[model samples]
Target: MTEQVYACIDGSVSTRTVCDYAAWASQRLSTSLTLLHVLDKESYPVAADYSGNIGLGSQEQLLKQLAALDEERAKLAIQHGLHMLEAARERVKSDGVANAGCMQRHGDLVDCIVEQQGDMRVLVMGKQGAGETHPGRQVGTHLESVIRTLHRPILVSTGTFKAPERVLFAFDGSQTSRKGIERLVSSPLLTGLQIDILLVGADTVEHKEQVKWAANTLTAAGFNVPNTAIRAGEVDEVIQHYCQQEKMDLLVMGAYGHSRIRQFLVGSTTTSMITKSTIPLLILR
Candidate 1:
């Protein structure tokens, strides 16, 4: 069966961008796409006791007005959620992606979505939303934790909506990267995709052998691969330049799963790709 993709919708411009990308992936990977939007009320904390204990038992007019206003606010939020779901569903359908649907569930948004991550192959979400990122997260809220929590790949968007033409696959020969590359090789979604396989490290003889192992494997699998190896500069900087030069549309990378990875975000390479790339990124954990 084709893998399933879960994408979050927040009724922002970026959400539309994310939806388009997800629909494309769904069609490309031959997978199902779930458009999820959560009505979050529990995550955001509110003031409970303001300035001592304010009694409300005796106030007739004040209590009634407050209750009415609260209900109005809730209705408005629900209305917004409905409109967002409909618009997103239309976008997904227009993209020609099948097996797609809209969801307007409730609860802590991240928590609700995270609950569904177990069965999903990837989670696509925007870097920012509704004029701000999620609270207590990275520059793009929920991205860091989402990556950390899920074993699946999480694609952090650049807010750019376009079909991917070229992909930069960062190679380290790590086990995680091994699985990532294997997925690429086995999947038909990348049948004719152009990949710029980047091998970055010291220009030592041993590293060249590592690259050979990767190249030979990919060549055997029938991929049109162009390669580059740079022994200088940071990983992020090198990737940015390559993206500009090659006009890379997406970045394919592996997730961090080791302690050596802790010194850098979940995985230094994954974090670097998200922070630096001017294009969208697809991570495989």
Candidate 2:
């Protein structure tokens, strides 16, 4: 059976690019891609303005008109969202992916993305959407929340579709890192790609040992992942530096490893990577 990939879109300009990249990945891996659009119910306001010149009797009619307008506006949003996703699915179908689909729902976007992410090998999305995405200066917090909450690998499409000729895997000797290595080794999505298995903070004894084991496992599985290490200040910085130096097409790493939910939320390395990487980073949880 083919693996499943779920992607979330806000119908932005990057929506097509994100879907194309997802299609590329699905084709590469022979996975089914599900395109999802989530309309946050929170985007709609519940309260109404009652004060008007025609005071008592017309108030009921005015409220009804207001409700109708809101309903129409909401329906338009849903239709627009579906249009973009359907177009993406059509494109994927044209490219010979038989199992591509488009789904739209009304709820919390982050929560919906996480729920759809269940049982999916990868979750593909844009870096950020044009909305009330808080902390929206450089990198939006909504993307970060999705990355941190969903325990699936996330592929954030920053720009155009580029087949990942070279992939960089951050080897940190964590359980998450091991899972990433296993996915890289076993998944058809990554086959025939030149990989750079980088173990940052390999200055520690445990880190070196884990890297050695990981490298051997990868090699034995028929993947030629060249191993390298660089002592670093912050882990994310090290990853960025190495990825930049190698001109890597994609960076794959674990989202978090054995951390409490609170710590995961507060001190998330995953967020750092999503916010900082020059190229696209595929984060596995």
Candidate 3:
């Protein structure tokens, strides 16, 4: 089971950006790249049930026609997925990752990811999927679910692609945040980049200590952590303003571990960052 960077390409507006980030990660990690396209059941549902007694013979005919239509639709979907994979492969290859693999699966996106995660080092995907039409601030329906389901790191790409020279690590004094820092240090993806450790909350002793620890860990691991700050403000607001002011290209943080009710009450910092941040996000779990 070789580790590979999996890039989910669904022919969305962000597909190219996803490919770019995935290629960047693959090159940085010195791993193979796999372009994955999942034919989700929700995207291509089965034919509707025409079982209502509108006359058995007519109903049977209608059912058969609908089934045939469904079959055709399935074929088209498969072809489209293959094309997407091929295009993604070409893009990644042009980005200096040669011999990239391609995969197409039929099932839920999360289920496919689970099945394929054994070989996955990291997953790069679009923040907005193909089904998203409204465009602004709307994330893909599967973005949160996929992030929650997979234990691996996920790089959510938005806007266009840059080399990510500067990264912002949104750190806190939690176990999860510490684990995120550990994982980030273990990987070579952000090795040569400048990362700023940020603790957005009270500027208390604990927060300051956490920021110090994160900076020290990164520094010990040979990372160029230029700045560490402990700000007193809302999590999302501080991170957003910091990213904009600092011109950070990538934002790294731990996945939100709160329950649904708690998230509803206080709002999810993870979702808020994903939705609001103009830069790409690297979420660790």
Candidate 4:
């Protein structure tokens, strides 16, 4: 399958940010961009039961009217989606991405993403969706589900996009972190950017060695490694502090456990970072 950067736009306030970030990633990876809009199935119900409520003729007429209304709403939604995609395409083109593709699918967001994962090199989405207005938790309803189901790297836009110059990788000497480092080395997404490694654990020799190995790998892969720090504190607190103190633009980390039970028992760092961080995140799987 052809590899392309997929930017999911839902007409939210963050749609423009998602487009900008997607364009940046596509340019860095030297790939084409596709602006995707999914019309959620639950947003428009198909049928309503009116059996035994009215006379047979009236019920039939009411059902027809309701069905017609639903169809009309669906058509309007499709038109809105197409307009959104076109606007997104133009936005990316203005950002130096010419001839970007546009796609519109009708289904659950996660299902649509899973179906289209074969051609996805990277997925870009906003931290919140269209319906999520309350600021209780800063994650979209479908974002977690998509992250668990899709295997590609996800670049989540937390706010307006700025060209990333300094990136911070939250590494913990685990197999997932090692794999994330290897993937970073192989991919051109973060090439020529200054990377700082942060490990939130004991300041022991083993932890220091882990940080060194990550730094060495990145440096060998032509990435500029400026600093590597092993600090002792809460995992989320330390990482958040480091990101703010060092003025890092992007946070790169490996996706945590896929098991729901594991996540329930021990909260996931990946999810926590996604929820609290103000900067964008690149989650590698």
Displacement of residue 184 (Cα, Å) in model 3 is 1.6
Which stretch of 10 consecutive residues in model 2 shows the poorest summed lDDT? 259-268
Q: Which ten-residue region of model 1 has the weakest summed lDDT?
A: 44-53
Kindly provide the TM-score of model 2 when superposed on the true structure, using C-alpha atoms.
0.85
Looking at candidate 2, what is the lDDT of residue 153? Answer: 74
Cα miss at 161, model 4 (Å)?
A: 0.9
Where does candidate 3 stray beyond 4 Å?
Answer: 46-55, 256-269
Q: Candidate 3, residues 1-285: lDDT per residue as tens digits?
A: 889999999998999999999999999999999999999899876455555744676577777787779888988999989999998889988999889999999888899998988889999989898998866488776988887778788899999999999999887777767877888888899998999998877778877887899999999999999999988876778888999999999988776556221242125555666789799988776
Candidates 1 and 4: which is better by lDDT?
4
> Across residues 1-285, which tens digit of lDDT does each residue of candidate 1 receive?
455988888876578788888888777778889888877775322223232324655675566666566667777777887888788888888888755867777676667766786668778887666546442123355566676777777776765688876778777756656666778888765667777777656677776776677777777899877775645456667667877887888887666655222323465454455656567877666
**Local error of candidate 1 at residue 45 (angstroms):** 7.9
Q: Which ten residues in a row have the lowest lDDT in candidate 4?
A: 258-267
Candidate 4 deviant stretches above 4 angstroms:
46-55, 135-137, 256-272
**In order, what is each prediction's RMSD in angstroms?**
4.0, 3.9, 2.9, 2.9
The lDDT values for all models are 0.70, 0.72, 0.84, 0.84
Candidate 4 lDDT over 144-237, as tens digits, reads 8887778889999977789999999888887667888999999999999999998887899998988999999999889999999988887678
Model 4, C-alpha of 169: deviation from truth (Å): 0.3
